[model samples]
Target: MSVRRLADDQVQPAKFAFNRDFAAQAKVWVSKYPKGREQSAVIPLLMLAQEQDGWVTKTAIEHVADMLRMPYIRALEVATFYTQFQLKPIGTRAHIQVCGTTPCMLRGSEALMDVCRSKIHAEPQHLNEAGTLSWEEVECQGACVNAPMVMIFKDAYEDLTPERLAYIIDRFEAGRPQDIEPGPQIDRVFSAPAGGLTSLKEEPKPAAKTKAAAGAAAKSPAPTQAGKPKREGESETLGTSRPVTPTDQKDEANAQSKTGKAAASRSAGAKAPAAVSDPARPAARKPAAAETVASVAGPATPATAGLSDRSRPAGIDRPAAPDDLKLISGVGPKLEGTLNSLGIYTFKQVAGWKKAERDWVDGYLNFKGRIDRDDWVRQAKALAKGGPEEYFKVFGKKPR
Candidate 1:
């Protein structure tokens, strides 16, 4: 790692203190640790400071150190050690961190850096003339599969071309960064194959009927001997008049050993009494095919069969002007199309979903618990009650 130091003295503030909200948040972070281990909060406190001021100043570092009751050097060591902390001021609107790791480098990260240099500034970590756009080349951002990516704030724009990067910079500069969706810029779903799935294309068929038939056959009773009464648990052996008793079989073997005449012993032993079944005992049944499958593989995913209509949110005719469901954080373009397909065209429809309805939609999307986690209903309610103004007021930021 390169030596990381604080900004020049002229740029450093006279002093620092967390604001009221940040102070409360700092206390919450500090409380997460034991009494004497408040120093463990130094990293989070410095991060909170950076989020508030847009960069970590020397004063902010010292302030965090004081709050945690640790030596200033200890806090400074942490801030300098982690590249996440911005020791100097960064762009107020967007800071593009280009991933220059091996994967990204092989995938045209150098061209991305060139675009940043030409558009934002001649050098990394420098802001544009407007002070709203800045960029720097950094290590991997964990999207190697979507390599040659650039991260603006928390969102990554991947599979980038120089032209696309230029267009993105312009959008951010124009104060409409949300116009460009995050993730792969091309036709890709997360890290999936860009041209669609290459393997597992065929849907799995249901369990074969042959297995069930075999199970049924195994459960059926065995055939009885010809011209003889069949008894429970009694089975016939070929070429024998009756089932041989253990003692008769042993005597026949002894007779055969002494006289070398097994045919006579067998003839004598063939007249032994048949074996009987216990009247009180019930027969054991083999498990059905479905039961056997369930025992081995557990239950099938509920999403595969889908949910009942009763749990589905009611649909409506497409309105002349439908609400943009994409504004909801978790709902992307593809997700919005899916919602539209389900007749969910307005925030009112989404906001009205009961827990069961939400669960149905969640299962249909195979989103696990993301719907609840993102609070889609609450976001829909806010957007439905009032437009973006209300959503911004409620969420303390613009709707995604």
Candidate 2:
């Protein structure tokens, strides 16, 4: 980088002030910062001065300093440090900044610079005869992906051939720069391949389901027996065998009593006393069917019992106007739809969930602990109390 200094004293203007329109814009920029830190507006104010006068004059720098109540040297340091601020007069129509970094150079940026030298002036930063065009070779302008580019004022013209750049220069010189669009000047879309996609050309197909998975999905939940109200524990059985109920237990007890009475009658008629087991040994009892099934199944998962869990939050019908659940930070349109499908449609409903209910919801969504992490209940509470205004007041930002 070359040392950047102000233009000669002879060329410097005697005084400087923002025009009426620029003064209003400067005020707006300053207002964005806190009162005591209005100095943060220095960069924008200097840029506005350049947009109005075509360059950052020394007077403009001091004027901006005074407006922001910052030291003149602090403002000068900003102007001189950023290359975006031009210290000398440039082309009245357009000042072209050609990228000369490695990527641009490897892609023929030298040829583009040669075109600029011949068309505008022999040296960089020197104005053409008509004072309507100038060119400067600058470092990367953050468009390396679209290399061999030129930035005229704020717009970038990328993917440039020497001839294309020449034509662009002519257009700007004729005061019709807007005729040419910015970005790549080729048969390409933004930084994409020049012709078309080279990989992943075929659309991906969804994975085919295996026979077992297909059969499992096709099978619906077993229907409850007719003439019986579904028991509380029965609904949580998933696709396994029906759970042992209180009615089943009572019937088993009655059958055992009848067998005992029959055994007593047989013993009364027996010729000899029935054989007794030795005191030191005990007979092994057979495991009940329920016990066997329980051992095989291990334990019920959340998905199996989610619908019948006591801790699950109570859901209500959709109101005349449902609260926009998307207002919560973590709930997008898709998540809002999922919540609606569960009959959750109001902020008050969400806010009322206890920790157990929250865990149920978290498990239902497979969200681990995201519900607690995002503080959805608190967010919902704020919205429930007074809508967005209250939410923003509590959180210090607008609801997502």
Candidate 3:
């Protein structure tokens, strides 16, 4: 939005000179944006002017306007907007900038303000009669823990009791070098540990659904006949699953076995112990399976038939497990979720794409040469079940 000219201040030239090295330095600010955006560099250019002169003057504003091709009024607008630049003349030697935000205010910042009024000057931006000190109340300085603090130029002096700030002010006025001390002057650390934490305890593993507490088999089966992969009449589609059965004496053996595999580990070092039988006393039967599942989100139908052949993504041959289709390399959890939602769950689906479909996924997913990078279809087909276990074969070559 375009700003209006101030009713009080006029578009006059700056009183101070923007020196040789300073003008050269000002060009660096203009370089940050694209061409024709040089006008956008107004704030920084004015700042450069303020740095050259103790406060921005009419001559400095005019210099910045000319340098950045901005109007003199527009340059003054930029100068007046930021609190950092002082528009009035300042002391030749020192300035005390006291913080007035809530934390600093709570920590006796008012006392520091009092000190400024008593020892330096009473108003926000005026120099003392001696011309060696000046003070103003400002905002949070990113050092909230060191509340009740003041800044001298850019360096913060924190944890002020009125006495401490008085001492600091005196030292600055006396031409003494105030070397910064390590750590906060106050008792608090950098940031407090986050509150409402509910998940840090070392939870015990629930008895495995397939094993007992000890993982030893309970009553070693009055062995019943086990069902094979199903018949022609069976449901082929992955269906909504049954509720969880809390592990009992019977599933103990599976627990001790700890056979669950982390597919990504890909080597022997990744495997856990074999399923073991339970030796503990028998489990007392209690609540139904329905209750167990409600404790957490109930399981949905297994993703088995999610996107097989007829339902295959337009250009890909198979489901794309998320990790493979990242925006940049090293895709993490969020990118994987995006791929899964787009129904591009496996490498095969991503690998195989029609030009149009590839464009849609790339644009929809906002992913940047994804489809044409590799022959997704052929590669995916190779990874297809009953095809030559190509996923393992291809990704398996440990590069030299």
Candidate 4:
């Protein structure tokens, strides 16, 4: 490793502080750690300081040590140890780090080094004539599969020929590095087959049905008979029994007595008043059978099931007054309306969401962990109570 120290007094500012933009970001990073452990945030602060000015400077290191409340040497130790922190002045517009590892070397990285030497300076880390560009040969940048790559700041330009590398440097020097796209120079995706995918080029065939699945299908009753199937160990008897008990005989006698009285009254020529069926014996309207729309596709996932339930079908009435769902930080007007349309109107409903329900909503809304990330339930509970007063009591501030 090259010697890493603060630049000469002429090169560094007398004092350094994070600019407003960086101050705000630094505050956020610092807040992530527990109290009195702010020193843990030193590495990121140093990186931010370096990012603010093209590289780490003496004043920047002291500024970070003060911000983190650590000793100057602690901050300096970190700055010197990580190769990522450039201790000297780097090119203001672009500082290129070329990978000179074995894989890159084998793939004509030497030619790239030659290109750098011819175009910029014979010594690495020296600025070009314009002072807008500088480069250094570094160890493996971990994109060896895309060997012969150069990283300008955060972006990696991979699969470079000498001509391509020269073009990239020229573009950066001209203050338009954005003109050159990153990644493989040839037609390929990151580390995939160079030319194109050689295998699994077509859609995969459906897996063969297992014997257990086939047997289950065979055992399933026909659709018409889905309502009833024979119970285990029961005979196929239709309204037949072995013998009558004493209680049955008594019930039969009572029934005969009622029939005799009715016959006698009819035979006596006495017209009985028009009769109505007993309310207790009135005909019943059978309930509709449980409907099943068998999908030709396959079994439903829990996510899909939740989506189906949450999707409001036509003819369901919208609530007269929907709750203000935007009280939750991430719930913008469009998302609130979407939630309302899906019948999730109130914060109470959102607050009640379990992990499974949240997962379902996440899938339904095409969100990637936004619910947990924003602590939607915590916010919703506060909103449902009344407003952010309760939220402030719990979380110490207003919702984002």
| lDDT tens per residue, model 1, 1-400 | 2467788899899998888877777777787789899899888888889988999999898888887778888998999887788888888889999988999999999999898888889988877898998988788779999998988887889999999999998898888988899989999999999989999999988986798799998987655556554553333433245666776667766765777666677787677687677789877789999899899998675544153468888889999999999999888888999889888999999999999998888888888889999999999999999988678557655698
> Which candidate gets the maximum TM-score versus the true structure?
1
Ranked by TM-score from best down, the candidates are 1, 4, 2, 3
Clash count, predicted structure 4: 0
Task: Tell me which residue pairs clash in candidate 1.
Answer: none
TM-scores for all predictions: 0.63, 0.54, 0.46, 0.57
Worst 10-residue lDDT window, candidate 1: 232-241
Candidate with maximal lDDT: 2
Candidate 3 per-residue C-alpha lDDT over 1-400 given as tens digits, one digit per residue, 9 for 90 to 100: 1232222355344256668766665666677779998998887777777677777776777777887787887887777676577766666666877888999888788888898899887776778988888877777778786677777765667777888777777777777745544335555444433242346557677664765634554644333223334343332232213332444433644544554554335575566789675778565678788888776766664333233334434533244333344422234558667666665666556545666666555556445655456444545554553233334334321111
Selected candidate, larger lDDT, 1 vs 4: 1
Tell me the spans in candidate 1 whose CA falls farther than 4 Å from its real position.
203-264, 274-400
How would you encode candidate 2's per-residue C-alpha lDDT over 1-400 as one tens digit per residue? 4677888889899999998767766777777789788888888889989988999999999999999888889999999888899998999999999999999999999999899989999898888999999888888899888888989998889999999999998898888988999989998888899887899999999998899998896784555544344556553323224787787667767878999999999889767777888889988799999999999999876453267789878889889999999999999989999999888999999999999999988988989899999999999999999998678557644697
| Candidate 4 residue-wise lDDT, 141-243, digit = tens | 8898998898888888898999999998888888897898888888888789899899999999899999999999898964323345545432223222335
lDDT of 4 at 308: 52
Measured by C-alpha RMSD in angstroms, how accurate is candidate 1? Answer: 9.9
Over all chains combined, what TM-score does candidate 4 have?
0.57
lDDT of 3 at 205: 77
Cα deviation at 196, candidate 2, in Å, is 2.4
Whole-model lDDT per candidate: 0.85, 0.87, 0.62, 0.79
